[model samples]
Target chain A: MTQTALAETRTAEQGMAAHARAWLDANLPDALREDRPSTRRNTVAELCDWEAKLHRAGLVGATWPKEYGGGGLGLRAHLDISREIGRTPMPESVNSIGKELAGPIIMAVGRPEQKAEYLPAILEMRDIWCQGFSEPNAGSDLAGLRTRAVQTADGWVVNGQKIWTSGASKSRRCLLLARTGPVEDRHRGLVLFALRTDTPGVDIREIQSIDGERSFCEVFLNNVVIPEEDMLGSPDEGWAAATRVLSIERATNRMHRAWRFENQLNHLVSACLSDPATRHLAESTYRRALAEVSVNIELLKGHVETLVGSLIDGQEIGPRGSLPKLFWSEAHQGFARLALEIVSQFPVEASDTLRVARKRMEDIYLKSRAETIYAGTTEIQLDIISKRILQLKRKA
Target chain B: MTTDTELNPEDFVETARAVTTACAEAAGLPERMDLLAEAGLTGILAPEAVGGMDLPLGFAVPVLRAAGGGFLAAPLLECMLLARAFAGVDDALASAIVSGEMPVTVAWSGMLGGTSGVVGRAPLAEACARVLVLGADEGGVLVTPGEGAMVETESTLDLERPEARVRVTAASGPELSADAVARLRADALVLRAALILGAAEDCLSRAADYAQERVQFGRPLSANQSIQHHLARDCLAVETIRNNIHRSLSPECAVPAAAARATFVGAATLGARVAESAIQVHGGMGFTWEVPLHRHLRMIKALAAQGGAADLIEAVAADLLANAA
Candidate 1:
């Protein structure tokens, strides 16, 4: 392309980003803003409605195909939208599993009919999806999952228990992974199903998490009959599909996180500054720590932007995604701890903003503990970096 | 010297690595400067009129990276900045510095007031023919140390290139505007970030190689989970620094000064941590002078101090607080 074309492309992207920023500023209500003291506890229906509105505004699913109720503006525009969403202290997507993980994998390996059916519904927020990859014994060793799915004359019958299935209680669909072969076949003979959660034998029980949210659930599939059309791909394609989902989960899933991290930091500082007793926490007492947090936020942004650029250039992220995964988890956890410490010091007569910040930070601190534990544990990320990225040989 | 339009910075990396490696064996400062000038590195950021390529500061990053990795004792970063600063203001001195005739270093701390003042943190000031100091008016002044000026070597963490305190009783040279000084300071932060990143990469490479070769407890040290985790963390830190540096240099950076300062501070702090981990990976041999891991660690510490990481952090914090809404 000529230099003029390149300049034009940049101008267009900047215009799109500016439009997104302005749209979000005008649309997002203060009652839904996480950073605002007036924010109320939004219900699942309210959050889902807001997300669907975001989709309508082209702020969500910007990269999904236009045939699937998406804007189809491409990854750069998606990133621009995500950045705008992140800059504001808005709530996380209630159906992120559907949009980020399940939707992308379905696009990759789903049948055309499946994509036509599931993709649009996901974007429309009509079908909330929950991932069913982790089992009682297969959290990190996902391939060792023992969920049995035997094909009967009618359909496929699945009997298994999945743990840590976030949003399962509210989800309408499950991206369930089950094995068709014996236990010895670790990665082979596995099958993925877009199982309906309201199926007769399927049971979902909420598990209260440390953050006092019952988002995490234990999904029990007892002779749950799944239709043949619901199979994601071929029987042996499950491992590949699962790995693809995991990699996306590690890399580009929720690309707004780094920006959100910065928003959280700014919220903490702003809250501290709202009160005389707490102002010194950000001004002088914990200045170095706050500065370190600011620096770490930049590093996290660097990682995310670099990955996005690489993806746009058609380069495979592969295990290189673990870098940001490890860095952000550890760094954000540190920031959460620091934020809690600062907010915990607020006086009894602190400002309402400080009280709201304290509550938000307390939840963040509790939820951050699971950040490293989930999305492949810190140890798993380290192992991937050492073995896959560094290619270090294992002990003989 | 080549014109800026005719040169590509990526094309100079191999030559820079080779020349800087050769400089380690050079007899003295002049030979080192000669080697660097021969490779066209000294004039990379200077003007074509002053016999320089007049390329962007990005062109000098690879050269300084090589210098830092090879531990070349000459004041290359200082010379490049000084030569660029003197380009139009004093073409003769810029030409001299670029042609390896006059070796120069910059006093990163203290300002020269009236006729004399003490300036410190000038690396290899005793070996250089000229030193650049900030003036009281926030401009830049080139000082040719002579009878009235005294150079005092300050014991520092970096033994090979200890910073010097120059007491300038009489100084006179071409003056640079305040804008030039500010630009030079920002440029210095970026270049130092690149240098520290290079040193950290070298340390990581050496540590990984040693871990693979060294056998302990009936297996290679790399097999140990603890050792592998350490090296992996170092790799993450190194990549973070590299990415941050690139981001700071990219045109998309919103605030170039703040980005550059963040890059320098991140590189210094994380680069030192990486070096420390590299030493731990090497066991006892890493602590000895023969191993040379300590040199990179020392250089990183000195760079952090010289760049005023603590003060930068405070400034960053102050900005964050003041912007609170």
Candidate 2:
């Protein structure tokens, strides 16, 4: 690119970020802002509506093709928008599974019809997706799953029990992973389906979690029939396609998380300063710990931005994605713990802000317990780093 | 004799590596300084008018990294920083330092009160004629040892080039502005982080190579899951520090001050941890003087102590609190 063209591109990117910041600042309701004392619990419908608005404003799916209800911007623009989104304390997307996972996979290996059908629906918040890769017998060892799909004259029959299926109760579709081969054929003959969750014999039961949310569900696929057209890719292509999408998603998904982590830290400090009894928490007493947390936050941002740069350079993330996943999960969990400890020390006569911070921090601390357990687990990430990135040998 | 515009910072990597390796094998400080000046590394960030490259600060990163990784026992970072600090203010001195005609080191800690005070953490001060220290007003002043100043070596973890405590009976030199002092300190933090990163990277490579080659119980140590995990964590830590350093240098950093301090503290803390892990992977061999793993650890700890990691951490916390909404 010429110097002038490069300068123009930079200006345009800056405009993209400025536009996102302005739009979000103007549109995001105070009631949904997590940093505000007036913030209240938002209904799922309200969150979905807010997300659809974000899409209409070109704040969501900025990099997805324009033909698929997206802004058709470059990945840099998408990253710029994500930073703005993260700087604000907005709620997480209610359909992250649909937009980040299902949408990307369909775009990659989906039939043209599948992309046309599912991609726009995800951007418009018309569908919520629940991943079905984990089963009662397989969590981190995803390939060890026994969820079997048998092809018959009518369609494929899927019979399995999936545990920890987050958002299963509200999902319109399931990104179902099942084996078409024998049970012993781990990671082979695995097929993926955009299975309709309301199909006959499909049951969803909510599981109450530590944070008092029933967002997690146990899904029973009792001979549920999935049409042949719903299969994401050709037979036996599921494992490869899913892994590819997962590797990218692990790196690029939730790009705003680092910014949001900063937002949380800022909120904790501001809340502590709002009350006389809690002011010391933000003062010299917890200074070193807070500084350490601040460093971790910067490191997390560094990991994220570095990954974004590599991706923009057309480099394959592969197992290197495990770095950010491992760092963010562990660091965010630590921050959550620290935030909880500070909030727990609030005096009996606390300010309204302190109470709200205590409540949010309590939820954050409880929910963080699952952060390391999810997304391939801390142990799984460590194993991948050592075995793949480091290529450490194993004993014969 | 390439001008700053003719070369990118990355172009210096191979040259820096080669020169640093040569310096490591050189007999004494003068030989090492000559090697650095001959390669134009000592003046990497100095002004072109002073017979220097006048390159950006990024140009010094690779040189420092090579120096640290190769265990080049010279005050190269301090010289580069001091040369830049002296440029324009004392062009002759800058030119001298850049040309390897005069050796100078900076005392990272302590300030001169009135005309005399004790300033410490001057690396290899005995070999240098002058030492730079913070003045009473928090600016920078250059003091010539034995010309109304004295140097006392304080032997520490790094035995090869122990740091010195300088006592100035009379201070006389060109004074750097407060802004220049702050900029120099911030730049020092970044350069120090890069140096520590290089040392840690070398240690990690050594450990990984040893693990793959050293066998135990009919299998190489790399084959063991525990060793693999240990090395993996060290790799992650090293990568994190690298990323943090890059972030500190990026133009998009929103809070450069906080970011620089964080990078330094992160590097100091995590760099030492990685060094310890590398030593562990080497087993008893690492504890021996011949392995050289202890040298890297010593450097990391000594650097961390030089700037006082706890103080940096608290300052970072104070900054965050001060900026709190």
Candidate 3:
């Protein structure tokens, strides 16, 4: 494109962003958009409706191919949409597993028939997917998962249990990992499946998290049948497919997370400004901590931009993907911890705003603890950097 | 943001790196400065009209990093900051330095003042044509010819860059505005931070090499999990400093001071850690002067004290508090 044409295209993108900002302002429900703890609840039906509206507005899947119900735009469009989404204090997207993870994986490696079958429902939030990868024995060593899937005449029978399954209780479908060969076969023996959560002999029991939420659960499978067509790729291609999904998970979701982090800091800063009492609670130490958090958040933002840039340029993040994952997770956890420290210092009979802030801070602190553990532990991340990116030799 | 007369940063950095590599084997400051001036790094930040690259301070960061990586003897970092300080305020001196006709070193006592007091130690003072004394105000800076100033050489840990105590008469030289002084200070910190980062990266790279080659118990030292984790964490700290530096240099960051301060403090502090770990990874050989790992360690120690983290933290706290209030 010519210089003027490029400028015009940028202007048009900015215009789309402005329109998105206005649309989100007009459409997002007050409760979902509000900062109060009471409004923080994610009611399933309402969130599903919101997701459908978002998909209709072309904001939910802007970077996905147009044939698969996305806006068929580039990364710039997604960034624009993210900037607007960051404005509202909305809860997590109710169907994030389907929308972010499963959808991307299906698009990248799934058969065309699988894409046609899964992508639209995911965009519409009609098929909520929860990951069933981490099992009782295979938290970090995911290849060790013993969720066995025996091939039957017309399908596969899955049996075994997955632990720490987020959104398992509310999900309609699952992106699962089950062993197709002997348990000792490790990664090569694993297969990825898209299984209906309501299938017979499948059990999802909610596990109360530290924050007293039942979002995470344990999924047990006993002869739960998955059709041959439901296999994500060829049998035994689960590790490759899951690696792609994890890379997408680390790259794409972070824009919103980074913005949310910014919003959280802004809210705290505003609160500290408005109430001398709140400011006095932690005083200089609090301000210093806030400063530290701000600098680190900007660092994370910069790191994310680099990662996303690599993605935009069609460069594989490869082992370098671990850098952003490690940086953002630690930055987020540190920010949440700072919030908790500030909030716990709030005086009794605090205003409703302080109370709400305290509650959210509590939730963030608890939720942040898992950030390092899930989606690859901090230890695992360091290992990847050391052995893969840094090319350090592993012990025999 | 680049004028047609401006140097392309990539080309500039490449040329700077070549000069750096060539100067790596040379022992003396004059010889190194000749190579550096040939590459135009001594005037990299000066406008092209004066035979300089006329590049922004951000562009000069890599050159500083490369210089720091090799422990080059040229006063490029000091020259770049001084050139930028004198850019609009004192074009004559800036132009002279930009033209590579003069080599200048800066003394950060507190700020520019004409008062007869000890200017903070000037690095490689004997090698420069002039020493610029910085005080609280821009106009407060006194530029004294390098030889005319009362100078006391001090033995320091960072032997690569010699340090000296200089006393100058109060208000003796051309003064700059406070705005100019602040910009100059920020630029100086950024260059120093990049240097620290470069030195730290070299430390890590050397340690990794040592770990890979040095065997223990029939395996490479890196084969040990403890060593792997140590290097990994140090690598993260280095990456953090790198990210902060890049962020600080970006156009959109409204307050570069925080990022600069963060990078400065982070680089020095973490650079020290990496240097220390690098020594440990080398076993007893690291303790010997022959290993050269101790040079990075000493530089990091010197840098850590250059601009105290306490002041940066105070500034951040005060800014955040003021914004909150």
Candidate 4:
């Protein structure tokens, strides 16, 4: 190898390792470090506080343009920061919809005014965002959504209901997709509005999912008025915007889940270490099952690493994203379910790790049940994969 | 045998693909073997100093995939894998392999003890000049000349490859270290995975083509969502295995154990499903021997048991649990 090339490689490795070390030391708080599975429930205030810390460290928005409050680093820096953050069991970003989905779309296709107005607030965690793509009837068949956005002399009036909108009650804004054209014009006539959750007609109803978390909510838009300027991209082209958003969402969100699963698996192992009953149970009937889950998680880590590299290189993942999504979701559901069974055998203890482990396991177990349902159901993903990627013909 | 030639992976894959495709339609095994050997594929993995390309072992993966795609019956992969074993360990044997003076094959799994009686027939043992009897229980793997061993050729489901059960009464030859034996086993698993992936790719493509061309109820079979989803699921399996292979080849991977685990999942398990789905797409035509789709199915069934998927899974699990502990 050439001396110059070898030196460059060494420099890159050293810089990445140094950043990882620094982030590990400063970013994790005592509460988070002690909470093995991170059972903080991650309230908006706490999440915002953590985001502020991340911002202070110049970790947030590493890939977004510098003028709009991003670090303006390359995508490699973004991925490196993400990998470092994954070493801990911190709660997911409170501004996930804003930072991951909404922010990337605005950067890619939003007008300069939209980027300037929203990107900084998103990076600073001042504006938390929730997605409003899936209506009650449009969960998998998203384009079949019936939400209407009629243009008025002043702005647009939106009236519809969005179901399974997680964090709606807490979020300040919604990255909403509403029908602007005729109802039958599926996918073509939709418009994405950066709708304010506090708009006069907006109402959020909390729904307690099986996981016992009221994070999922139903949002009712009763004649909410969104100014024409708030639309994300061109009117009647929200389908294209939605596609790009979903692609970015799938690419970044799933990699985090893969790493988070690794963290959960580690906690499960730690719980087994803390109690003899669980350890014995794990060794006896649950060894292979637990081990297989571990294998899958490892496989997922490798898969995600490759994916992250591709995303950084600006390579198109396209329908291939469905592969990781399917593998990780099924793997997590299986792992979490097995963990609940095994952890249930452990003696009740006041130890922090044990206490947090039980809670995290229960939450993950129930939550994983929905993993296959959300972000496009397994069936929908399979359809996309087969029909689009594999070039299979539609049934006549 | 002295040479210092560098080999590029893309070139090797293209060359092997061309040769394997030509040999795929050959009349008999000897002709296919001759064609592949003439293409310099038989010694592709031996060090260039030994009259071979001495390409990185990573290159062997895609070549094997191509061979599996064509179902070429030349025992090319076994020779490459065996060449990896013989490199530096025996210069004379490695040179013979590069020049096609001697063709070697190894058992799927075997042991070191001669008195322990029959070790099941290794893969392609009947067709090779020598068979490497891998020592699973013992620390050292032994090389036994094919002529000295009690060999009996047997009919198998996978007609493209032949096998034999041999009792190695003369068990003496070059012995490999325990580490070497483990490395060889891991290499074999990786190559096996490539073959499985190749076969899966071909099966899926063939199934997709058949679905597109064949009409049921006045529409292509692919028009059916069920068939599309079946092929889609197979695509996921194949892609995931490919991802795993790329991961295993990364320089950061210090050992091939993790790669073997991936191979076990991708090759041993998914390979069978893909072949089955391929046949399902073919319906009645797939049931007959004339279509050649059944060859993949038979190969999958045979290869799935070669490296013990269950054991590989256990190893992967154990390593992870140990790390957790």
User: Model 4: clashing residue pairs?
Assistant: A395-B223, B107-B122
Instruction: Provide the lDDT at B28 for model 2.
Output: 87
lDDT (tens digit, per residue) of candidate 4 on B1-325: 3233554566767887898888878886566766776787877777776666666667788888898888877667777766666788887887777666676666665574643345654667676777767554554444554544665666666766766676766566766676776776677777788888888899999999999999889989888878888888889778777777776776644345665576556567778888888998899998988988889888777777667777767776666567777
Off by more than 4 A, model 1: A1-12, A38-40, B1-8
Put down candidate 2 lDDT per residue, A1-396, tens digits, no spaces: 678876776676668989999999899998898766764568888898999999999899888887999876677888889989998988898899998998998988998899999999998989989998888889999879998899999999998899999999989999989999887998789999999999999999999998888998999989899999999897777568878989989998999998888888888898888877778888957777887888898888888887888888799999989998889999999999888888889987887888878887888899899999998888888899888988877874
Alpha-carbon shift of residue A233 in model 2 (angstroms): 1.8
Best by TM-score: 1
Interface RMSD of 2: 1.5
lDDT by residue (B168-210, candidate 3, tens digit) is 6544666667777677777777788788888888989998988
Q: How far out, in Å, is residue A344 in model 3?
A: 2.6
TM-score of each: 0.96, 0.95, 0.89, 0.90
Enumerate the candidates' DockQ scores in order. 0.67, 0.66, 0.48, 0.54
Cα lDDT for residue B168, model 4? 67
Against the true structure, candidate 3 has what lDDT? 0.76
B210 in model 1: Cα distance from truth in Å?
Answer: 1.6
Off by over 4 Å in 4: A1-14, A25-27, A33-42, A237-239, A347-355, B1-8, B27-30, B114-118, B136-142, B146-148, B152-157, B213-218, B252-257, B281-291
How would you encode candidate 1's per-residue C-alpha lDDT over A112-131 as one tens digit per residue?
A: 99999999999999999999
lDDT per residue for candidate 3 within A1-396, as digits (tens), equals 578866765665556678888888788776775466463466798889888998898888887877989876667668767867875677778788898788888887789999998999899888889999898889999878888889989699989999998999899889998888887888777788999999999999999988888889999999999999998887766568778667767766746676678778777766655667776654665766787776566566666655665576788877777777887888889889888888887889888778877777788899899899888899998898899878996653
TM-score of B-chain for each predicted structure, in order: 0.96, 0.96, 0.90, 0.89
Model 4 error, position B161 (Å): 2.5
